[model samples]
Target: MSLLTHSRQRTAPSNTPPSRGGGRRTGRRAGAARKQFTAWLFLVPTLLVFGLFAWWPIVRSLLLGFQRTNLVDPAVWVGLDNFRALLDDPLLGTAVGNTLLFVGLGILIGFPAPLVLAAVVTTVRRGAGIYRFLVYLPVVIPPVVAILLWKWFYDPGSGLFNNALGLIGLGPFSWLESPDTAMLSLVLEATWAGMGGAVLIYLAAMAGIPAELYEAAEVDGAGIRRRIRHVMLPQLRSVIGLLLLVQLIGTIQVFTEPYVFTGGGPENATLTVLLLIFRYAFQDGEYGQAAALSFLMVLALALLSAVYLRATRSWSRS
Candidate 1:
């Protein structure tokens, strides 16, 4: 009888219904696993495509930087010889200096013009949309087309600029023909071409600023300039910093203007790093050197970006 009772007690526990919560928990775990599997199923193709197209090319380029190949002949392993050749090339210093000059000029002329234009447009009570449209029109225009249009405007003899200046007896200027004016001309066109997007960004940011801050400044006896200095400038500080960094990166890699307009001519005065890379790869058939130089430029830009981000990390948090 005692043995039978013990067996019955053990059997009684097994006979009890399974806890409802435990069943639900198992179902929920299965459901979560299915969802996770579905998510990964959808993500796999995108991952594969990105790896094949983007990551593969970057890896290939990195490998190419150390190899000498014309994409036809079998690649020869050159180790650091490509980099050594780049360092030995005198044109490298010229290209770097010219690129730096372009960046400096872009900062001086291109950076502030957008902010100023946005501020002026904000003052206009009517036709603000029309003003924005006009400002942004150039961005829609093809870059090559815009450069060609400016080429006509820069003509030394019968150009619009020369004609306009002739009325004031200012005489004709060699805008693209002379090395002195060539880079400045490129900068001007680039500024005009690119400022539209920046202007719109500034305008959007400005619209988000509370009017009460401006009103409080007015109440505190602040004039227009003072209000801008104290209120507006502080608000736009981060935006300004971001755009400045973007401009610096863009100008340093300038290629199209020098290539299309000057051909890095007038004694290679307008020659830039990117154009030099193009020359190395296409003109000189030194593909390895071109890749090495491009890799170096990438490293430089990465370093610059890292430094800027590190410097701004604290300021951005505040």
Candidate 2:
């Protein structure tokens, strides 16, 4: 060895701890920190946007629930007065009952319609793209515009539906003018406009299912119906459960179709909770009452969602 190297080795300290992989680990942690910082930096704008537009409305609604404000004057604190007003209104019960009926009908029929439609669509071999396009086309139309178009179809005189039924000797019926038929009519319109979204989602999920599974079922002598029963439905259970929850929440908030179609008319048969809130806020300018109702609706939905989630936790796992 060189005399200088030998002199350096002799003078080197013996107390330094030898690092096994400390340098590598430190580099990794620093790199991870940098990556995390970069990710947060990119996400800040989106988070801020959601906070301003989405979360802010909810926070404002809660605050306004306790105060009366019409945006033209200073807000006045009314505490529980707005809620008490809602409680005393006789129409409030009608609206709630109608809303509950809507949700129940959707659960009974609307929830399964899309699933059945998607399954049927999958079985179509010719012009599949055209079929999907047709199935999803209604959703592309603005709901207000669609409701207006449907109003013509629902006309009591010379209407398409009644005209068709007339050919079969089914007497002309007032679809929207009668209280008994009005809610059903709204439900029908809602199902037509809404089922398209669920159908598309189900189609996407169906596409992800393994073809080999179906082939195996066929090899085991499973027919089409049996295959759907044992394989398709099982694969779709989680998606179905999720859509059911969404439908229940959405049906409770049914507003636009009822508003545009009947204006909550025919003795307020189509009146729903949201329409009542709209009337309070815009028609009567009772902002406090509207906010109070909105909060109550939110609370009811939240409780329902909690119960539904608890009930379906096992369903999801399966």
Candidate 3:
């Protein structure tokens, strides 16, 4: 009996309670519960709004995309008829082609303009703030005002563009009248209006880059071109990728500029995907087709975003 008692005393822990491990586990569970409650509390408003506005509407649109309705009668399920009709429509092809062209041209001209402007501004020692403000001014202008201003500027007889060309002995070209020039004119306007945002973003990104990198390059006997190529370009890769993706997504769905300026006229030269969707839904009362087109556009944007995200994964890892 004595030996057994001594063995028991030796095996028992002194510093901890018999239920200490279980108590610690229980405390951890309580803490986790509190954290979960706080998370839910923080998420309540966003979840409520998303469920009410975003998810509900998305589900309803999906259902409507497969049905036929005329604003009064019950929606009749028509299966894939709307999609089939859309596939067969000639204007669908035209809209797609025009949208791709518009996005391509917009990217060609608009994407690089901001980077160049930012670089130029960074190189300026005097009046940099004034130049930045002037460049950013158009971004704050109302879309209608900007479009009207461009319209006035593109006027064949009394426009600044025509006057400049005339000084070089060129004839006053009809900007919005000809199909060949109408889309180009719209693209030019979009480039001018949208460039400000890009410039600001690039400028911020460039400012984040350490000045020591340039100084180090100079110490190595590097000239301006070499410094920019080795120091600036590599540092700006992620920013350039992000801006390119954003520009591509936004330009693909361009509506206001073309709608207010050309009205998709001169043989539908300026008709974009969003404009086509607007015409179908509001003008032709084809909500189902318009919904389908909207869905396709969303899918395209998702794919582009995914590609860019993958390309910039290195930035996140770094």
Candidate 4:
């Protein structure tokens, strides 16, 4: 009896491999690999589409920058000559100056206006949604429609602005006719059309701010102005910085407003880099120069974004 019992206990838990356990583990690994393969298979179409459409065009543009092409003849390698020609162009300085001025005016007049509007709209108890809708309505309007409407308002002879000013004893003034006022007019239209998006973004950001922070500031005898300065602005610094960067990039690439309104008109007073690029390609038929300018602009934007991120590391998302 004792010998049989001892033999049975020893055989019950021997070191022999459990085939079922090993099979389970192998099955688990096989399932995992199949799952991974399926996931990647699904991703293949998207990757291929992006590579073909998005990435290929970018690579082609980079390559074409150093070569000359008119879509019919074989591309001829020109190796930086196009860039040099752009540098030597007399209108380059004018375009850059106009672009810089546009950016400056946007920062000063355009940026703060939306912030103020958002702040006021936030405080209103009644009809808040109506106010928000009104502010954002301009954003939904088609660009061409809005630009045409503003064109009528900017008409020097019988424009709404001139007619209104004349009633107040002011002379009818040319808003977009003169070179001096053309850039400003473009900015005015741009800011009006653009600020709605910023306002909505800010309002969304403001919604996320902790109510307790506002209450704490108020308990400390803070007025509305004080609360905004101390509590709201600090909370929004990151959003504001992000929007500033976006606006700067967009403003530098200003094309549509100037293109539609003036065609970089009144002696190229409102010409921007993008407009110049368009002219180079379509007007002058210098595709090489256009590609070169596009490449340089991309490099500049990259450098600017890097510097901006470094400088605003505290607020930026990198």
Compare the candidates by TM-score and give the number of the best one.
Answer: 1
Model 1 scores what on Cα lDDT? 0.92
Cand. 2 Cα-lDDT: 0.93
The digit string of per-residue lDDT tens for model 1 on 58-77 reads 78888889999999999999
Mind giving the per-residue lDDT tens digits that candidate 4 earns over 1-318? 699998998789768776798899999999999999999999999999999999998788888889889968999999999989999998988888899999998888888989999998999999999999999999999988999999999998888989999999996878887998999988999999999999999999999999999999999999999999999999899899989999999999999999999999888899998999999999998998998888899999999999998899865553
Looking at model 3, residue 292 earns an lDDT score of 74
Question: lDDT of each structure?
Answer: 0.92, 0.93, 0.87, 0.91
Which ranges in model 1 have alpha carbons more than 4 Å from their true place? 7-12
Clashing pairs in 4: none
Query: After TM-score superposition, what is the CA distance of residue 81 in candidate 4 from its true location, in Å?
Result: 0.9
The clash tally of candidate 2 reads 0
TM-score per model over all chains: 0.96, 0.88, 0.89, 0.91
Tens digit per residue, CA lDDT, model 3, 244-267 = 888888888899987899888879
Rank candidates by TM-score, best first.
1, 4, 3, 2
Number of the predicted model whose lDDT against the real structure is largest: 2
Positional deviation of residue 301's Cα in model 2 after best superposition, in angstroms: 1.7
Candidate 4 lDDT trough over 10 residues, lowest sum: 309-318
* Predictions: Cα RMSD each: 1.5, 4.3, 3.6, 3.9
